[model samples]
Target: MNRLFNLVNQQDNRQLLMNTIRNGRVANAYLFHGPEGSGQEGFALEYAAMLNCQSRENQPCGQCPSCHKMKTLEHGNIHLVFPIRTGSLEKNDPPFKNFGPDDMEEIQNCIRKKAENPYEKLCPFDGKHIPINFIREIRRKIYLTAPEPGYKVVIVFDADLMMEPAANAFLKILEEPPDKTLLILTTSNIDAILPTIRSRCQRLHFPALSTTDLGNHLRENGIREDRINLVMRLSGGDVRQAIQLKEADLGRLREMTLEALRMIAIWKIDKVYDLVNRFVTLRKENPDEFDRLMLSISFWFRDAAILKAGKPESDLVHADMQIEIRKFVDYYTELDAFGAYSAVDNCIDLISRNVYINLALVNMFFKIHNRIQPGKSQ
Candidate 1:
């Protein structure tokens, strides 16, 4: 068993994939669909290792030469494609496409980090998407055929991030790949993938981790029990997010979430402007943290909802904020907590679609304001 699969607590997926390999039912192309932080990508790498392992029995002998290469992600047969941003995108470029020499170095470094930690994010640049050239490079290698005898395993992480042209170009390869090739497309949003492409691949779903597993992992990380309880709720069984939240000093994000609620509750022009600007900076400086900030607020409102529904404070995820939640609930006698949560969720959706941050946030502020304090001006 791969060590990373254990890290992600993907026992079921591990069994399923091992069975596929043993039964010789591996598909030419597979779609790994699951929520973010699930073990889709990790399992994809593990599957590649199993297929290319040198030993016939007791597959993926980590001691084998091919297995060692897969461990470092330097195997000649492995093709990894993810969202990438380069300084240039020259039409006639190959391998790296428009990427300059410096970009290639950075990419290698990123790969080294990925080899170290499977969950390390690949792209440093923002708003990157899978490019057509990357797809072409893989197709080129498949046709050229490397000298080595191994499965040509192509794993495209976040496949839904590919734009239409790239997706369309990819469909050609997906529709018809060489005999010894396997392509796995991993995505958190399957609906974003084109229907044509989806229809052609064998789909495998990765379910979120269980709360018990999440808590046990957090405990192993030496996180405090108090924080573990909160993370178990906020991370929603997302293994990567649980790890990130532990290292990210998620307390700061929670504090910011509380402060942002106070700002919105004020419903003043200057305060709202300052809040939005702060968020813009957070989004640019630390996108993951910013995302958690929004997620944190939704749960805060959920806690408020619990209080409004006459539930005890023990029912609140934000039990520490019981006093504040009680006061907020008391003040807004007609507050619709779910509606407020939806307003924030809508803002997350808008930002995800590359909507202007200022507009998305401002619209969210006003929407919540109107929902709770009807006709309230900001």
Candidate 2:
């Protein structure tokens, strides 16, 4: 079952789950919570398979009929639930009642991608909430007799997105979870989950993968040897993000960051606005693009700060850009490199929250400059 992805970093979580299977003391429900790209969702799917596997060995042999279905997330007894934009619908209208043909097609595609790689970031149409109708269907299905010989498993991805009605409905299911039925919830934002729900389920925290583990995973994926270190650091211990950086050509993103800094330092409004448009506009269409850019920007300032402290290039994330950083630090002897890092870091958080984008980006100029050239009139 672990073959679906590299969850080696979550060894404790894996052992805990396996011990339950070994001890025949499975919980009625479980919550897999962690940061994005931490393999929470993927692990839920595999655990579901393990519970339903036809083998008597207490683990998925990856060869049974049930295992085959679980591999592609097509099992009859396994219910894969997630948030969707299915507005106002009946309480028992079945899953995806409001979805049209196109929507269904898109969802199937996203599911296939997820089945292939659970960490693959996907959004069919920016799903904002889980409908209560889906919850009713889950309640209905679990109370019925088993359609198959394995335990009924229902997995809800991003369970935090459930609205009030849906959340309450799910709480009831958790309160009296059916026998031979397991419901697993995976969420990146566990704080958003209702504490009532949290108290009922066994909570498992999935920590970020170590750089060494991420590096190994990237190597297996054929990421360039030279880019492995940079990708590992930039991914913040996320394997999916590491792949995204590798595919997006992280070197180009670094160049973009350096260019923006050069333009911002001179306070050229026309050119800066042009660059900002390129950044903000693309960010709306491709968030990973903007994420790469911003993370790269932060690294530039981090390198500058490291250089300012007279540290070795070995300590820099973008050590290859040492020459450019050295000159930048030398020219702006008063540059508050630490302040500059905080500025971009804060901007990243703002943009993620959907704050005023244009102003927020433009302000970075004054903010970074003020740090370097304090008390100077713009």
> Cα-based RMSD of the predictions, in order?
5.1, 3.7
Per-candidate TM-score against the hidden true structure? 0.75, 0.85
Please tell me which predicted candidate would have the highest TM-score against the true structure: 2
RMSD of 2: 3.7
lDDT of 1: 0.80
Q: What is the per-residue lDDT of model 1 for residues 49-166, given as tens digits with 9 covering 90 to 100?
A: 8898888776778778888888899899998998877445665566365566787788888888777766565664543798787888778888876656788899998899997878
lDDT of 2 by residue, 113-221 (tens): 8888888755568888887887988888889988888899999988999888889999999998888999999999999999999999999999887777787888888
lDDT of 2 at 257: 78
lDDT of each: 0.80, 0.82
Once fitted onto the true fold, the runs of candidate 1 whose alpha carbons sit more than 4 angstroms away are 1-7, 86-92, 95-97, 257-291, 294-298, 301-315, 319-378
Stretches off by above 4 angstroms in model 2 are 1-5, 121-123, 265-269, 276-288, 326-336, 346-363, 366-378
Each candidate's clash count? 0, 0
